[model samples]
Target: MDSSIITIFLPIALAIVMAGLGLELTPNDFKRVSKHPKAVLLALFCQLVILTSIAFVICKVLTLPPLLAVGLMLLAASPGGPTANLFSYLYKGDIALNITLTAVNSIIAAFTLPLIVNFAIQHFMNDGQHVGLQFSKVIQVFLIIIIPVCLGMLVRYFRPELADKLNKPVRIFAVVFLIIIIIGAVAKERSNIMQYIGDVGAATVLFCICSLVIGYFVPRLFGISSTQARACAFEIGIHNSTLAMTIALTVMASTTIAMPAAVYSIFMYIFAAIFGTLLNRYAPSVQPSIEQAPN
Candidate 1:
């Protein structure tokens, strides 16, 4: 929570995390999007439109505090976390589709996140003077997202062995960084932490459930295979809470605004596991021979 950590360490940690995500991505992932146009487009529509609308409705219906409302909206606008790929792999989803969704959605989020945040600020904050991410800050968001990812991709493209070597460590550091950010956000707003949970807790859980459901069922309803639907489920379910928290804590400079993401981070993985279990047991389209289905 120190200014030094907020201003310096957090951004660097975020960049490393984003770069680590890039290490998983490559030009082929983007190209793969072309092979699955329906899955790709529907997934984007769910992320940018449907889920965001659901988040807005939850904020309004729950009457979340203004900062907290913005925070939830911010999380909704965020792309799938990098971990979606891992979840997809574990759940026997289409890994290629997962990678494509993650890659494309992240790039789209750089622009859409700021727009969504700005709308949330104007609607929810009322008298709050925190100017939402303006053009300069939008540029900052783009750089924060794009540059490290591109650097990581370049590393992967050139020195794949080195990229592979650094990947796990960078991911470990990211998890540590997320824990610290959540703790720092909670610590900074300790008195309000309990109140925050009481207020936003249900909404976060509801949003998480809706995200997974919409990500999966909608795709299936449209005739997409269950494997692709599971990929969509995790991709849409496990948000980039790190990115949301970072933008809230560092870019927006509000611990209150960071609270929803911190709280959501606690529930996402647990729920994803449960959801995956049900899918694998009941309606799974993934072949059972895959080694990770049980893992």
Candidate 2:
């Protein structure tokens, strides 16, 4: 319950995860963003527009507390990470596009995430209470997400084989690390579990569905292929709740604020899997490869 404990645990966990992220990536991953501007822009648009709007509605309609509401907004603001790439590969979505989107989104989120969270706190908690983003917390994000990533990129630059070899173990660590964070968060907030179960659970599921729907529709309107559309849908729909939890715990030290994201982490995985199955079954066939570069 101590603020210092939460602050200390959250950043260390996030930093480890970021280091795992770095171990798996190459400088080429970041470079891919420039090569696929359309896909990148499309994902960004969905994140800012569709996801944010849905989050606002959920927070308001569900009457989410200020901290939880802000947490949801933070989660929505984050981009797909390595997990999205793995999911995309599993679901036969474009792996390259997933990587490019993840790389770009992570970089953009440093600025966008704080802005979004701060706005949500102010908007939802119009009452006298004010919750602002601390400069120190944002700096922690920079250190956790950005700095480790740069180091990993350097590893790839100087030691390609070493980077490649670390990938599997790092990925394994990601899974374990994520599980611990979720479990610990749940344990810490065990008393509030019932209070949050219905509202946070239902809203998280709805948000995930909306994310997938928007993910598919926007790209389809832009004439992107069904496969890429599916990829974007999952990427944009299922946020990196880990990032949200990290920020909540490290910066705000409020378990209440971290609830939505913790709930979301569970919901998105289940919902996205179901959505992927339905999309693959019911969606129209991909016309022979169009060969257009992903924007």
Q: Pick out the ten consecutive residues of candidate 1 with the lowest summed lDDT.
A: 286-295
After TM-score superposition, what is the CA distance of residue 184 in candidate 1 from its true location, in Å? 0.8
How well does model 1 score by local distance difference test? 0.90
Report the Cα lDDT for residue 68, model 2: 73
Runs of candidate 1 exceeding 4 Å displacement: 287-295
lDDT by residue for model 1 (1-295), tens: 8999998989999999999999988998888776667888888999999999999999999999899999999999999998898899898898878888989998999889999999999999877466488788889899889999999999999999999999999989989989999989999899888999999999999999999999999988887778888999999999999999998888888888899999999999999999999999999574432122221
Residue pairs clashing in model 1 are none
TM-score between candidate 2 and the true structure: 0.91
Taking all chains together, each candidate's TM-score versus the true structure is: 0.96, 0.91
lDDT of candidate 2? 0.75
Tens digit of per-residue lDDT, candidate 2, span 1-295: 5566566766776776776666666667677666666766887899887789888988888887777788778778877757777777667677666766677777788778878877887787767875667788667666677887777777777888988887788788777766777787888889878788765888888888898889878988998777777778777876888777777767776777778888888878888888878877888545322235444
Error of 1 at 15 (Å): 0.1
